[model samples]
Target chain A: AQSVAQPEDQVNVAEGNPLTVKCTYSVSGNPYLFWYVQYPNRGLQFLLKYITGDNLVKGSYGFEAEFNKSQTSFHLKKPSALVSDSALYFCAVRDRYYGNNRLAFGKGNQVVVIP
Target chain B: DAGITQSPRYKITETGRQVTLMCHQTWSHSYMFWYRQDLGHGLRLIYYSAAADITDKGEVPDGYVVSRSKTENFPLTLESATRSQTSVYFCASSESSVETQYFGPGTRLLVL
Candidate 1:
């Protein structure tokens, strides 16, 4: 049972506004989404992916992500929010019946780019 | 890039003792991973490798034990420690196998 869902534990944006961090996935075939960012204790800092062509995918720093294969979802966007872009946000998935490229994380979402 | 490195960063042992967690990567990336970060239960794959002898088992490989012979090291041994294996251990690298995944600077275990 491949899974990844970050129903949001916290999100508050207001630096330049325009941010969204929400991801949804459950795969069995065709899914490779990823977006990570963590800062309080360091580690994790790759911010974008959605393997298999555009549905809007751009990465690093000024992140971007949006791959919604009919609501299976993959959302993590930022038009201009910064305060160093808050922290803690993860949503990952990689599965195809799990052959071992291992990855299925999500239960983290805490962004507070307040000003 | 002096990427990935996870050592004693912080540790405290007790419960049944016997622990070893050290991962080093200088971008020899052939894929190597071992994760465990508890808080809200995220990042939880417990072993992986794709070079140097190869290894695999993820989504929590109970009691953990891994090795990669060589390819920038990959060590994770626990054999007996448990207290839910007090977590925070993370070591990652990638050059393939789905790409971009490079983290390290995590190794905070405490089981007493």
Candidate 2:
């Protein structure tokens, strides 16, 4: 079964410092990876996605993710972190071969940006 | 003005009572989905509708019922609500399978 794993339960970083949230996925065929961020009491907001080409994908709010095929990883990164960036991050995977179209999500990682 | 919306932003119900969470999307996307967010579980899909009158089960579908009589509405009903059913439910829609999904504000349900 296709699944995503977020190893870190929490990540604390200083404001203006680079931030990295790790994510790894397992799928039967090509992996369709996505990154989402959620604020308190709010629904998830899409950050980025990796479908086919270009390992590095950019998304909203100065977020970017790199898709690694060999390692089956799609890690979210940002050049500089902000206090507002502190939120819950989720990594999701979708199987490209089958038509089920259900997304498998990771447990999620809470990011804290210390000002 | 054009986005997804969910009804009853917050709800509380007794166990074994039937509760329905409403979801509406103005984008008229071809795909609609229901998911529950828990503390340990990021998000587990409950049901999804490809189009009007076309519905399918997702990862976790038991104890829930859904109907897509119209293209814009996808409501999820818990036949018999349980204490474990307390969760934050989200409704999302996408133009197609590979398209980016847009989510609503979400409805928080608490089963006592």
Compute DockQ for each candidate against the true complex.
0.32, 0.82
* TM-score (C-alpha) between model 1 and the true structure: 0.33
Fnat for every candidate: 0.83, 0.71
In model 2, the Cα lDDT at residue B90 comes to: 97
Q: Alpha-carbon error at A106 in model 1, in Å?
A: 9.2
lDDT of 2 at B73: 98
Per-residue lDDT, model 2, residue B18, is 99
Please give the TM-score that candidate 2 achieves against the real structure: 0.98
- Stretches of model 1 off by over 4 angstroms after superposition: A1-16, A20-29, A32-65, A68-75, A78-85, A98-102, A105-112, B1-11, B14-35, B38-44, B47-56, B59-77, B80-108
The DockQ for candidate 2, computed on C-alphas, is 0.82
The most accurate candidate by TM-score is 2
Candidate 1: the clashing residue pairs are none
Predicted model with the maximum DockQ = 2
Q: Which stretches of candidate 2 lie over 4 Å from their true place?
A: none
lDDT tens string, model 2, B1-112? 2499998899999999999999999988999999999998889999999999999999999999999999999999999999999999999999988877888889999999
